[model samples]
Target: MDSFPLGVAPHSAVTIRFVEALPDPSPVIAEIIGGGRSPGRADRYCAGPWGLTVVVGLAADATPAQAAKAGALAAAALIGEAIEEAVCAIALSTEASVAFARAFRARLFRPLSLKRAPRAEDLCRLGALTLVAAKPKDAARAWAPWQAIAEGTEWARSLCAEPGNRLNPTTFARILGGLGDLGVEVEVLDAAAMAREGLNLHLAVGRGSATPPCVVVLRWRGGENDAAPSLLVGKGITFDAGGICLKRAAHMEDMRGDMAGAAAVAGAIRALALLKSPVNVTAVLALAENMPGSRAQRPGDVWLGHAGKTVEVIDTDAEGRLVLADALSWGCATQKPRQVAALSTLTYAIMAALGSHYAGLFATDDNLASALLSSGEASGDRLWRMPFTPADDPALKSEIADLRNCPPVGPPDAMNAAGFLRVFVPEDIPFAHLDIAAMTLKAEADDTLPAGPTGFGVACLVLWLMAKG
Candidate 1:
C-alpha cells in the first residue's frame, strides 16, 4: 500500500513515508474538504509539490475540525512522498539532497535534481499513479509514456554536457557501435573511409581538429514488412571553434553543446528502442571537432562531397553544413529512406529570426514539411516552416565550385542553409533541414522543463516516427 490515490477517499486516516532523514519538521497542509462541497469542510488546499504525509477525517461526513485534522495529515504524508521521490530520483549526494529538501521544504514541491541522481523508478511510480480526478484512466496511462520520454531527454542533455576530450569522435563511434547489440546496425565511416568515398567536404572540416572525424550510421529495423526506412541525419561537431573563420573565445564554452543535435538523434534512437516501435528508423551522425590548427582547412578551400558535388568553403565557420552535406548525401544514397530529415546547429541566424522558442524547419517537399510541423507541435518542440524554392537556392551558388558552403550572409541564413542541404537531396526525394541551434541548449526558469541542455528534439522525433505509419 505504498501508492497514493486520486479522487475522494472514504477513510478517516492516511499515512505516507519520508524516505530521507530530516533535520527539521517541515510540514505541508492540503485541505480538501466537504464531500461534494459541504459547508463545514474546507474548500481549497495547498501542499508542497509532491510532499509526504496523509491527513485523516472522521469519515466522509466528518465535522469541520475532524476534516481539518485529516487534511493536514494527508497533505503532510502525500507531500513527503513526493519530496522523497524527487530527491531520490535526482540521486543527489545525501548532504545535497538533505540541504535541498530543507531549503525547499521537502514536505512540498519536487524539483528536478542537477544530475542523474536516484533511480527513475520513483518517477515512473509517480507517473503511473498521478491522475486528474476528472480524467483518471486516460491521465494515469499517459504518465508512464511521457516519463519514458523525459528519461531519454535527460540522457541526451547529459551527452551534450559531457566534455569534448572524454566523448570525441572515436569514443562516440564506439558508444554507438554498442547499439548494434540492441538491434541497431551501426556503421562508422572514418576520415580515410570518407575520403575514399569522395566525402571531401566532411573531411575538410575535420582536417582542422586533432581528433579524426567519423560518420556513424545507426539503423533500427522494426518494420519487417516495410520497404523503405525513415532517415534522420545529425551534425555532430564534438566541438566547434569556427576553424579558420574562428569564433571569439567569449562564450565559446557553450560550443561543447554544439553536438546537441547528434545527441538528440542518438537519444531518439534510444527512445525508439525503449518503446520498441514498429517503424524503420535510421540515424546518421557526423562526429567532428572544429579546431584552429596549422592543418585546419582555411576559407576558400574547395572539397567534394558524397554525391560528387564540390563545395567552396567560403567560411570554415560554416562547417556544420559541410559535414551534414556529406551525411545527407550518404543517407539518401545508401538508405534511400522514404523521407530524410537532417538537424544541426548550423547558424545563429535561426536564433536571430525565431529566437529560442522554436526550431526553423526548411523542407523541399510540402508533405514532409507539414508532417514535421504537425509532429513538432504535438510534441511541444515546435518548428516554423521556411521556404526553400529554387529561387532561394540561388544564394548558395558559387563561382569557384558547384556551390558555396554558405549563402549570401543576411536575414535568411537558416533558410539558405536548408536550401544548401536540399541541393544534395535527390530531386524526387522528400527532405527537411532542421536548424536546431537556438532551441537545443536554450532554457528558462519558468519553463515547464528546466534550462541547460534541453533535449528539445528527441520527443518530437519519436512522435514523428510513431506517427509515420
Candidate 2:
C-alpha cells in the first residue's frame, strides 16, 4: 500500500487561499480571477504568490453542510499535480470555519497511485497543507473524523481502479489482510473451504477464471463483546466479461470495476476501525472473477445456493446476485447479525433508471432504509428508494427453481434483481440492498470527484454506523 500524505502541517508548503466571499482583490489576485463573473461557489484562481486560490461562496440560504461541500470541491480541484504545500485561509465563525477547513483537507487528499514509471519531476506530489484558522485546536479536532472518511474513500477508489489481472480474488484477499494491522479480525475462506460449506452459487461464478472464489470477512469489535454486529456484504466480481453471455466490445474495459461493492465495504470497515467507533461491524466480501471459459456456468443451468435454495440461471450476465446470495446467506446464518446491508454493481438497469446521480436503495426494513437515506444525504452518496413490493416478486419466480437469476422480460429490472436477493435473507432480519451500478464509475468530472471511480458508499456506510452508535 502506498502512503498518503494527509493531515495538518507546519507553515512551509505552498499556500491555498480559501475565501468565503471574495473581497476587493489585489492586482495580482485580480489578474488571476480574470473578468469572468463569479458563480459564487467553488470558484478557482491561480495567483502567483498564493499558488492555488479557491473562493467558496456561502450563500445566505445554504446550509453548513453545503458550504462545507463547496469548500471541499474547491480544494479537491487542486489535489495531485505536484503542489508541495497549501494553506486554506477561511474567514467565518470559528465553528463554520473549522468545518470548512476540515472538509477542504479531506478533499485535497489523493489516493494510492498505480503509476509504474517514475516521472522526471514529481507528479501529484502534494506533501502537506496548513490550515490557517482562528481556532486551530477546534479545527484539528474536527479533522480526525473527516480524515478517516477520506482515507477510506481513497482506499476504495484505489482498489476499484486496479486492473483485474493485478487484483484477482487471492490478491484482493491478501490486500484486505493488511487491515488486520488496524485491529480488524480478518478471515479468508478459499474455494475448498467454500465447497465444504456448500457455497456452490459463489463457486460457479468463478469456475471460468483461474483466480478461484473466496469470501473475505472483516470483523471490528469496538462495541460490547456480545453485541449483534451490523453486517455488510459486497459482491466482489473482480472482472465481469458477462460469462457465457458476453458483453459488447465498446465498453468492455470498464468491467474491471465489477468489484467496487467489495471495495466500498472494505473501505467502510477501514474507516470505522481507524476512527475506533463504538459499534461492532462485520463485512463479508464475496470475491470472484466472471469469464467466458468452457467451464463457466452457462444459461439454463441450475445451482443450489448457500441458503439451500435453487436458482435458475437465465442469463449469465446477471452473475453478481448469484455470488451475493452465498455471501449474504453465509453472513446472516453464521453471524446472525442484528441488521444486514449488501452493496453490488448488480444491474445496468439501475443505471438506466437512476442514471449516475443516485444509487437504487431497497430495504425490507423502513427504519434501516430511512437511516441509510439520511446518511446518504449527509455524506453526498445519495440514494433514491425503489419499491420492493410483492408485485416485483413474480418476475423472480421460476418453474424448476426457487428463483430465476434474471427476469424473462420486465421494465423494473433493478427491482427484480433486488427481489431475487430478497429471497436469500430471512424476513426476521432487517436488510437493505444497494444497487450501485451507477455510482461505481463517473463519466464526467465534478467539483470533488474526478472522472473515474467515485468510491460512493464508504462515507455513507461509515456515517450510518457512527449514527447507530
Candidate 3:
C-alpha cells in the first residue's frame, strides 16, 4: 500500500491502522480484533510492543460522508492517547479521500496555546496525516481540493477559538486583510468611510463599543474580469454582548463565536482562490461588536440603513439582521452579483426548529434553494429549507419603520429574520439566507466535528460555488 501525505498538518498526531480481511495480521492486532466487534467501529488498544493502536473499520460500500465521519471519529479517538505517525486510511477514492482528509484535520483542531508552557506537550501539537491512496494519479488529483477544504475549515475554526478581547473589529479586519497574500484582493472600509457611505444601521450596532466597526470586502477573480460573481455577505459580530438587552449571566461566553459566519465566508473565498477555481466570488463581511453602553440604541429605536430603509429595533440583541441588511444592500449595489447569500448566527429560533443537525436555509427561488440543498448533501454540512416569506408572519411589520429587526409578539423568529432580509435583496437576483445558529458550536465531540465550533458552511459554500463546474 502506498501512503500519500495530506498537505495540511493536524493539531495532534495520531496513528490509524487500516485493515481489511487480509490474512497476514500482526500478533497484537490479531489479539485485539479477536475480542473486537464489527465493521464501522473504531477501537483503541494498548499493545505491549506496538504501543497505542487505533483500529477503524470501513464498509465495502461506504459513502463519502460515512468515510469522512469515520475518519474524524478515529482521529479524535487517537488524540487523547498521544499516538502520532500514520493516520487512518482505507485505500479511498479521490472523493472519499478528500472527504476523510477534511473531517480528520478539522477534528484535530483545538484551542491555540498562547501562554508559555513548561513542557513541550503542554502546548498544542501539530502532527503529520498520511492517507493511503491506491495510485499516484489519485493522490495528485485529490491534493489541491483537499488542501483547500482543510485550510478553509481550519481557518474558520481558529477564528472561533479566539477570545473576544483579542478579536474585535479592527483586529478582525487586519486578519482578513491578510487574505491578500492568498491572491485575493481585500479592502476594508473603516467607520468613517462606512458612515460617509450611508451605512448608518451597520454603524448603529457598534455605537456602544470603543472599537470602531467596518466592512471587509474580499474579491477573488478566478473567472473572467467581467463575469458576474456570487456575493456572500456575512454578519461579523466579533462579540455579541446582547447590547442594551443583556443576555443571561450563564453561557454568555459563547458569544465569542458570533463571527463564525464571517470567518466561514472568508475561508470559503480563501479556498476558491487557493484552488484557482474558474468562478468569481465576492465576500462582504459586516464587522462589529454588540456591546451595552450609554450610546447604544435602545429597544424601539429606528435607524436608516444603506438601502434607504428604516429598521425598528424591537430587541437590541437582534442585531445580526441589522448589520446584514446594510451589508447586503451595500454589496449588491457595489459588487453587482448574480445572486446573494448571507450567513449569520442570527436567531435562537432556528435551533429550536432544526436543532444542530442542520442549518436553516431561506431562498427567494425554488431552483436556487434546491441547488443549495444538493450542495449541502454533497458536502455533509446539511441545510434545511424553510418555507418563509415576509408575508408568512405579519408581526414582522414595524409601526414606525420600513422593517422590524425582530417580531414583538408570537411567530417563528428565524423565519421572520430571514424574511426581513428579503427586502434588501433585489427581486432580479436570487438570494439565500443561511441562519447557522445551532450549527456553529458543538457541545460535544461527534462523528464529523470536535467539541467546539464546527466550520459549518465552508463546505456548503465551496460545493455550491463549484457546482457549476
Candidate 4:
C-alpha cells in the first residue's frame, strides 16, 4: 500500500494551483495559467516560486471525477522533475478538494512495475499531498472514506498488475496471508483440505499446474459475534492458459490478470478492516492456475462439485465458474451468511454486451442488485444488470452430468455461467454475480486510474459493505 504524507510540506514546496471557474486569470494565477480556454482542465506551465508548478482549473458544474482527472494531468507534468513535496492550492468544494488529493498516491494505477527504470508520466508518481482548502477539517473528513477506498483499489490493482510467473497459486496465497496482520482472520485451505471438503471442481482447474491451488477465507468480525455476515466469493485464476483448449498466442499475456476478482475481494476486506466499520464479512477466494500441462484435465471430463452436483466440462476455457461453484457452495454452507456476492473474469459474452466500461451483473434479489448498481455509480466501478439463466435452460443440459460447464455452442455464455453458480447457493440467500471480464486491463488511462489493472470491484464492494452497515 502506498502512503501519502497528508498535510506535510516545506515552505518551498511545489504548488498545484487550481483556478475554479476561471474566465480571465486574476493575479493569483496570472503568472502561472497558460493559454487554456476551458476551466476544469490542466494548463501548461512549470517553474514557479518552488521550481516546478502546474496550474489547473475547474468549472462550477464540475464533478469529483473531473477534479481527479484535472489534478492527474497536473501531477503527470511534475512526474520526472524530482519535485519532492507539493501543496494543493485548490479553491473548490470539500468533495472536489479530496478528489484532487487522489492524484498523489504512489500506487494508484501502476500497480507492480518490474520495469527496471522509472515510468514516464504516471500521476501517482507524485511526491506529497497537502490540500489547502476553505475548511481543512471538512476536507479531511470528506477524504477519509475515499482514502480507505483508494487504498483498497490500489491493493487490488497491484495484485492484478503482477505477471503470471511472479504470481502463481502458492505465491498468490502467500501474498494474501499478510492480510492476517491487519486483524482480518485469514485461513488458507490447500489442495488436501479442499479435496477433503469435496472441492473437486476447484481442484480440477489447478491439476495442470505444479504450484497446487488453494482456497483462502478471510473473516473480518467488526460487527457482533452472533451477527450474520455478508459473503464475497472470488474466482482466483492467477493465470488462464485456457487449459487444453488453448487461447490464441496473440494478447495471451493479458490473461495474467484473471485473478483480479480475488484481488478485489481481498482488497475490500482490507478496506473494511482499515475503516473499522461495524460489519462482518467473510470472503472466500478460489485460487488456481489453469495451465495446459501434461496432467491437465481434458475436455468432456466431469467433476462432482462441493454441492454434490456433477458438471460436464464442455470447454476448458470456461473454468472460472467451475472453481466458483464449489467456492460458493462451501462458503454459503459453512458461513451461512445473510447475502452473497461472487465475482469473476468469466466470459467474453458479457464484455461484448457491456463493453469494458461496465461489468455484467446477475442477481436474484432486487435489493442486492439495486445496492450494487448504486455502489457502482458512487464508486466509479460501473455494472450493468443482466439476467441469470435458469437451470432448466436447454443449453445447460448434459447427457451424463447434472449440467454442462458451458454450452457446446453459445452466445450467452455469461448468463449460463451465472446460472451454474446460482445452483450451488441456497435459495433463501440473496445472490449477485459480477462477470468482470474486460474491465481489468486498459490500453490507456481513464478519469480515475491509469492504464493496466483498474481494481475492478474493490471500491464498489467497500462502499456497498459500508452501506450495508
Candidate 5:
C-alpha cells in the first residue's frame, strides 16, 4: 500500500483521492470527481516491477510549500517508475510544474541509463531515495546530467520555432559560437572565404538571400589518440524559401527546421563535450538562407562542388543536398575523416515513408549501417536504412554536369537525394547520409524528454562515438 503502482497498460489512467481525512476523502472527493477507484489503486495491487499506490495527504490547512513538497515527491515516484521502461509522458498540472521538474531531475540521480531502462534493483533503489525538500515555486535544482540533455533539447525547439528572420546565418554562427564555453572550438566561415575555397554550390544556393552565407564548424577533440576523426556534416539552410522555385506558403514557416540537421550535429557535439566523452568529433555545418530573389541561382544552373565535380540544378528546392554536397566534399577532401556521415532534413519522401518518428539513413558500407542501426535503437533515436544503389543512380543523371543533385521523378525522393550525394564521396572512402526530416521534432512532450525539439540524432551520435571510444 505504501509503494507506487503503475497503471496496467500504457497511458491508462489511475486516480488517487487524497483529502484531510481518509474516511472523509472517499465520499466527498468521489462525489466531486464522480469516479470509481481505478483497478490498481487498492492496497493489494500487484507488486512485481510495479507496486501498490502510495497515498499521502496534504491537510486542508497546508501551506503551498507543504503541498509543493508533496507534489514533488508524488511526481518523482511516477517519473522514477518510467525510468524503468525508458519512456513516459507527464501531463502537466497547473500547481505541480515546478514540483514535477524537481522530481524529474531527482530521477536521474539514481543509476539511470540513457541508453535504456535500468535493472529492477537500480530502479527500486532509486524510487526509495529522496531529496525531500519543501518547495513553493522555487527554481528546480540544476541536475547536471539532465540539465545538459534538457538544454540541448530546448535549444533545438527554440531554434526550430523561431521565425526565419530571427535566425539567419550570422545568428546561427553566433549560436555555435556561444557553445565555445562548452569546449567546442567554433569557427564561422563567411561567403567570401567559402568562395575562396571554391564552395560554389554553397555560394550558389545562398546568393539570393540578403542574410549572407556562413559555414560554421564545431570541433571536439576528446579522444586520447590523434587519429583521423569521424566527421559529421550537417546541411544548415537557415531558411529555405525554395529559391526561384518557391515553396508553397502552406507550411513554409516550418522551413526554420531546415537547419535542424545542423542543430542535431551541434547538439551532439555539445552533449559529447558536456559528458566529456573520449571521442574526437568534428561537425561541418553549411549555413545558408535559400530565397528566390533575382540573384538566386536558376533552375538550369550548374555549380562546381568541392571535389571539382559539377552538379546540375534540376530543382532549386533540392537545395539541402547542394549545401551538404559542398560540406561533405570539403570535409572528406581536407579533413580526410576516417568515416564521413552527414545529416539533413532534406526530402519530403522520408517524411512520407517513415512518418514523423524515424530518420532515414543511407550508407554505402553495411557495417556502418549496422552499427548506426544498433546505436539508434538503443538510444531511442531510431534510423531506418533506405537504399542508395546503382539502380537509383540514373534517376539523378544530368547532361550538363557530372551528376544532378535531384531525381527527375520518383516516389522514393529520399533515396534519390542520397544517391545525389553519393557523387561527392571518394571511391575508397565510406559515407552515409541521414535524412532526419521526420525525426527532429516531436508532437508532444515526455518526462525524460521535452516535446518540440526531440534532438533526435544527438543521442545516437553520442552513443556511437562513446562505443568507438
Candidate 6:
C-alpha cells in the first residue's frame, strides 16, 4: 500500500494554462499544420519541436460541465504515451478556468506503477502541470476540493488495478488500514470471526479461495453529534473466477476488477477524510474471491445470511449479492445507520441495458435516489435509476429458501439482483444499490479517462456526502 502523491503536485512533467481563447500557435504547431491558424473550440494541437504539446480551443458557449470534460480530454491526450510537458489553453471565466484546470489535472494523473522494469526515460519522472486562471489567486482556493477528490479517485484506481496476487482480501484490508492516518478507524473481520457471527452467505462465497474472505469496516466520525452515520457497503470480490459456473475464456482476465466497488467506497471515504467533511460515514467492504475448487459453494446451495434470511444460490457467478447481503444486514443492525448505499459490479444485465455510459441505480428512498442522481451528474459518474417494483420480488422467491440468489425466470436480471439485496436492507432505512458493472473499466481511452478503471463512484459519493453536510 505505497502512498502516491495526491493530485498533480507542481513539478515539471506537464504544464496547463487556461485562457479565454487559444494563444498563438507555437512555431512547431504551425509547421505541423502548414502554418494554419489556431484550433477552434474543443480542438487541440501538439508541437514536439517546442519541447511541449498543447491542447487548445474551448467553446465560448460550453457549459461548466463541458469545460471540465474538455479539460480532462485535453489532459488525457498528453499523459503516459504523449509528451510529459503539456499545456491547456482555454478562454473562459475565472471560475470556469479553475474548473477546467481541476479536471485537467485529475485526468492527467496516473496511479502508482507496479511495473518491475521500466524504460530509462520513464525512470525518476518529475512531471508537473500548472493551471493559470484569469485570477490566479482566487482560483487557487477553488482547486482544493477537486484536488482532494482526484487524490481519492486515483487511490481507488490504483487499488483496483493491482494484480489479484498483490491485492487479496487480506492485503486489501491492510491497504485500507493506511486510512487510519486520516482519522478513519479501520477494522478487519476475518473468516472465523465472521463465521462466529453467522455471516454464512458471505463466507460461503469465498470458501474455495485460499485468500479467504473478510469484512473491512472503516469509520470516519467527523460530524458534530452522535447521530446515525451514513453506511456504505461495497462488494469486494478481489477476483471472480465464476466458481463452479466458470466463465468463458474470452474476457475472464478482467475479473480482477470485481473488487471495484470496495475500491470506490475506500476512495469516497478517503476524499471525505482528506477534505475534513463534517459528516459521519461508515464503509463496510465485504471482501472475497470467487474461485472454483472442491470447497466452493455449488449451485442450488442455500445459506442463511447475517439477517437470518435464507438465499438459495441459483448461479455461483452471481456471488456479489451474497457477500453484500451480510455486510448490509450487519451494518444496518450493528451501526444503525440512517441510510445505506451499496456499490458493486454485481450484474452484467446492467451493462447490457445501459452500456458503459451509466451505472444502474436502484433505491428504496426517493430523496436519496434523487441526491445520488444529482451527485452523479455533477461528478460525471452518471447513474440511471432502474425500475424496482413489488412486481420484481416474485422472481426471487424460492420454494425452500427465503429467496433465490438468481431466479430461473425474472424481470431483467439486474433488477432481480437488486431485489435479492433489497431483502437484506431493513425497510425502515433508506437504501440505494449502485450496479456499476459497466462503469468500472473502459475498452478504450476516452476524452476524460484512460483505458482502465474509471474510479466512477468516488466523486459521486463524496459529492452526495457534501450535499448531506
Task: Encode model 5's per-residue lDDT on 1-469: one tens digit a residue.
Answer: 1222211111211212111112122333333234443321211112222233333344434444444455444444454353332111122232343333333433233211222454542343222222222331232332333345544544554566555766788877886897799888888889889999889999999989988988898888888666878899988898999999899999687787899888878877887788787788889999999999889999989888888988888789889989988898888887778887798898878988888768899999888888888989865579998887674467777887788877666564787788878878886777888898887655454334333445568767767776863
- lDDT against the true structure, per candidate, is 0.67, 0.79, 0.79, 0.79, 0.67, 0.80
* Whole-structure CA lDDT of model 6: 0.80
CA deviation > 4 Å runs, candidate 3 = 1-28, 34-43, 46-51, 59-62, 80-83, 87-89, 114-126, 391-393
TM-score of each: 0.74, 0.87, 0.89, 0.90, 0.71, 0.89
Rate residue 221 of model 6 by lDDT: 92
Query: Model 2, poorest ten-residue lDDT window?
Result: 5-14
Error of 6 at 61 (Å): 6.6
Number of backbone-clashing residue pairs for each candidate, in the order shown: 30, 3, 0, 1, 0, 8
Q: What does candidate 6's lDDT look like per residue over 1-469, in tens digits?
A: 4453322222122334333334554465555456554554234454454355554556645567777777777665555443444444434556676667667766665544544565542332325555445655566566667777877888888777777777789888988999999999999999999999899999999998988899999999989677789999999999999999898988888898999999999999999999999999999999999999889999989998899888899889999989999999999999989999999999988988899889999999999999999999988899999976474467778889988888775444888788888888889999999999889987666677656778889999999998984
Cα lDDT tens digits for candidate 4, 305-398: 9998898998888899899999999999999899999988988788777888799999999999999999998877899999987768877889
1 or 3, which is superior by TM-score? 3
Worst 10 residues of 1 by lDDT: 6-15
Candidate 2 local distance difference test against the native: 0.79
Q: What is the alpha-carbon lDDT for the whole of candidate 4?
A: 0.79
- lDDT per residue for candidate 2 within 1-469, as digits (tens), equals 2242221111112223333333333554455446563544455555655566655556434455765776677666555444666554444444555456546654554433444564422134555655544555665666667678877877888788777777789889998999999999999999999999889999999988878989999999999999999999999999999899898999888898999999999999999999999999999999999999879998889999889999999888889999999998989999989999999998888887788889999999999999999999888789999987474466778899988888766564888888888888989999999999988886655665555677889989999999984
Q: For model 1, how does the per-residue alpha-carbon lDDT over 340-439 read when each residue is reduced to its tens digit? A: 8888888888888788888999987888888889999866689998776465467788998888987646654776777788878888888888889998
Of the candidates shown, which would achieve the greatest TM-score relative to the real structure?
4
The Cα error of candidate 2 at residue 413, in Å, is 0.5
Candidate 3 per-residue lDDT over residues 1-469, each given as its tens digit:
1132211223632222232222222564566667764434565554534355566676535567776787787667665455455444356665666666666777766644454332343333436566655553665565667577667877888787777888889888988888899899999999999998999989999998989899999999888888998999998999999999998888899998999899889889988888988999999999999999888889989999999988899988889989999999999999999989899999978988898789999999888899899999877779999967646456677889877888786754787888888888888999999999898998877776667778789988998998852
Q: After superposition, how far is residue 401 of candidate 4 from its true place, in Å?
A: 0.7
Off by over 4 Å in 6: 1-34, 37-55, 59-62, 80-91, 112-114, 119-126, 389-392, 409-412
Model 1 misplacement above 4 A: 1-82, 86-137, 389-393, 407-412
Q: Where in model 5 is the C-alpha error above 4 Å?
A: 1-147, 410-412, 443-451
Candidate 6 vs. true structure, TM-score:
0.89
